[model samples]
Target: MSDDEILMHEIDTQLPVADFSHSSPCSAANRVFVTLSGPNFRINNGFETDDMEKLYSGLSEKRSETKQNEFPLIYLIAPAETTFDQIRSAIRTAAKAGFADIFLVTKRTPASGNYLKHGLLLRLPTASGLSPPSIEPIFVRSDRDGSIFINTGPSQEALDHCREKRSLPKLNETLDNYAACARAGGFEPIAQIHIDSSATYQRAIDVMNAMQRCHIRHITFTDVTSTPHRTCQGMGKGKPGTPTQSPSAIPRPPQIVNPVKR
Candidate 1:
């Protein structure tokens, strides 16, 4: 079989299963596939290694050959056993190498057809791209037990604030409170989610859904090491003075899945 055929075969066998709950299909053109197998990162199911520098180099070369203004879309295939930190690092490296668009590849269900042939794509923000000065980024972290914490800095006080808010089960309400506070201060809120190494993909999905429900779509996935130290914006500050509407009362974000190629 040809190289393309071989790569497709590898993706079919190794991609993870995720329920994006979107009906739109992803296109098959102008895209590159990267997979994480155990401890190694594989490019197009070919060059495989644990060294991130090599992976960055490979992605940079691919970036150089793409269209002048259009970077090739990246399809990342990581199994359930892979850590969110691993996935975050891969995405950060890809962005640093000049590839802007990236997606997490997964099947709609376990019994679904070959992922490459029939699967849903979850588009991830390329990196912490520049935002308006009027917008401030709020840091978020999710624990394995479905507890989520949010703060504006990486200091111990911020950490403690997150821990305090862990007992709160209403994620959507907590996030909405933050967004309202930021808006009240004339600053738009952007969320930079920090996914722990032990956190599962399902937890990440839950967090994403919560962000969507709160109308916070300008989200970025950040690695633990790159967290910034800013002034602590207390997590408890967003508690609404009056009763807030439920998440179901909000309109959903528009689905923008690319057209499928025949």
Candidate 2:
């Protein structure tokens, strides 16, 4: 099967069961992290025109609620060339709708395996050749044991859209509804990353460093985190420069306190 097909299948199998309802809601009272997956979908610049319009129009309504603290959406995709006007408009819509946070997923240094780093997620757009008008994106690393939760208000709305509910009249409206779900009854979102590759150790260290520099203050990897005994898509032998060792297989390199000679 094609990679997209596999990913779609996996997502289908992974999804939990739940009933749909306009009034009946889920939870969005807590903080969350959402990780997006699929075949580098984020980096692909030109989407079907219909899809792009549908996505943005949907985003507009969602943004309206974001200002009301009704729902929030976070992105997890590799950077790519994107139009500034479109991106800014989306952000504005999000702000107007009561949305708060928007995070990005960046490539691990030495790029290889399923390694991810948070805090540095924003840099990927630049790395990938796109820049938003003026927005800050939280970066998060995907390695070891990681999860992304999205329960703020529009949780149900997003879930419904993802499911492509037929009863919903307009695709654009779906975004706003989902934002409401996230804001109203937030649901937790998660995506685990564990792969055996030579560059794993270095990737982990880079992620940790980025986290520290960004002042994200609540990540841990000591006893609770370990390399899992499984493999994932796009996870095989790494490229050069990456130290060949799974995240848990080797010790992280020492951080340089000061490089310039006094």
Candidate 3:
């Protein structure tokens, strides 16, 4: 079997990636891209945590009626090997399903793994000349046993640029040194595995659904109070109070602070 077929069989037993697009025109738009990684021991297995803190950022902004059309684009970052074939398969599947974007970050392989040529799977579009709705691949470099550092967000452009300048021996040496340092002191093996793609994807979907519901509520409230006058008891009377709720009912700030400020 092909690598794609092998990965498909290894991960899911029920359906193919192509089957995901059949649900709705917006199904792909609601899909979340998740990256899986762990200690070398658990690298190929699943995660064991349900940490949703990173995934819930910016939810409120997109939860309003005016922005209901927008959905959350989730990118999971982990220190694993992101193969080119897997990246291509995901992009093709997501593109067909109408997703806005797909993203993943994995560890850079050593000279082995035949990843030099196949590594293009992780490369993102620096220009429109390549493809639409670009998929980002982040490659983290680690020493033989170092904990990996993953970059999955806006820095994709910088990494791609750096990768292009591979001829620089100085740059290559710096990365190697850093990886070695990380392996010596920073590497933390996972005691227990937790969160994985399916869990993260479900949380994303839930967040999107909640966002849509919140948007609907906002619209309903706006429409209820937008009227200047209401016909009540056979008399045209102006409503004094629109009966609106405070946006701060939950007492939340615009952003979260780490609290343990020095």
Candidate 4:
């Protein structure tokens, strides 16, 4: 059988259960199917292990075998219980292994209660591309409670914006304003999103969609360790260490930082 058919067969037998109720049907010719099994990840149902070093090594060898400049799309089949943090780590690992594009698989229904006939695809942010040197990337963090923090570095104006609107519905506006500001400063609008470990996959997707709507297409995922601070806080007024402003006032455009240098 051809490679695609072989892949479909593997997917049918090994892909983990995921909620595809809100996803739309889609297909791609160049793709690899992966199943997230707890601490270990399975690639195309042929390899399974919890050792990240081994996983990266294997993937790198496979990548080297492919034609130059060709990166396969990763279709990750994750169980419904998979947390956003796990998904993000998987994607990061794939990126390190020389893969770029990734898709989260979803299915409308299970056929015969045994296998999935087809899957709905959610195109994740490309795992490879880096923001251009000329553009300063803004950082966005999603809290466990689904609140968004937009940091543009020490900007009170940005902090005020976040304080006023931190919900997903207002995410578009928040990103748009940042994009506009970046453009005004002669830089491309790129956002680096960091998802909390407790956040949901749906929340990550929502943030991604919001970034796209604001024309901030150059996106990347960042780990918590990379950021200067985990959570954004307001410079409180009055008594020492007292935050006169509401906790919501903490979201703001952080000072522009060069991601390439970080």
**Candidate 2 residue spans exceeding 4 A from truth:** 1-54, 61-71, 80-90, 107-117, 120-262
RMSD of each: 13.9, 22.3, 23.5, 15.9
Top TM-score hit: 1
Q: lDDT: which is higher, 1 or 4?
A: 1
Range of the 10 consecutive residues with the lowest summed lDDT in candidate 2:
15-24
Scored against the true structure, residue 130 in model 4 reaches a CA lDDT of 26
TM-score of each: 0.58, 0.23, 0.21, 0.56
**Runs off by more than 4 Å, candidate 4:** 1-30, 106-136, 152-167, 184-186, 224-262
Distance from true location, Cα of 21 in model 1, Å: 16
Better of 2 and 4 by TM-score: 4
Instruction: Please give, for residues 168-188, the per-residue lDDT of candidate 3 as tens digits.
Output: 233234344543554466431
User: Which residue pairs overlap in candidate 3's backbone?
Assistant: 47-194, 47-195, 48-193, 48-194, 48-195, 49-194, 49-195
Candidates ranked by lDDT:
1, 4, 2, 3
Error of 1 at 154 (Å): 13
The candidate that achieves the highest lDDT relative to the unseen native structure: 1
Mind giving the per-residue lDDT tens digits that candidate 2 earns over 1-262? 1112111112211211111111201135422232222321221233322233444454444344333323343443332222222333332322222333433334333354553323321110001121221211121222222221222224312211221121222322432444345335543221222211222322333333333332322221211122221112211232222211111111112222211110
Give the Å error, residue 139, model 3.
20
lDDT of 1 by residue, 26-59 (tens): 2355577888777998888688887778898988
Q: Between prediction 2 and prediction 3, which has the larger lDDT?
A: 2
Cα error, candidate 3, residue 185 (Å): 50
Every candidate's lDDT: 0.50, 0.26, 0.24, 0.48
Error of model 1, residue 233, in angstroms = 22
State the lDDT of candidate 4 residue by residue for 104-179, as single tens digits: 5432234425333323233232122222235556677776656677763475122222322324555666777889
Candidate scoring better on lDDT of 2 and 4? 4
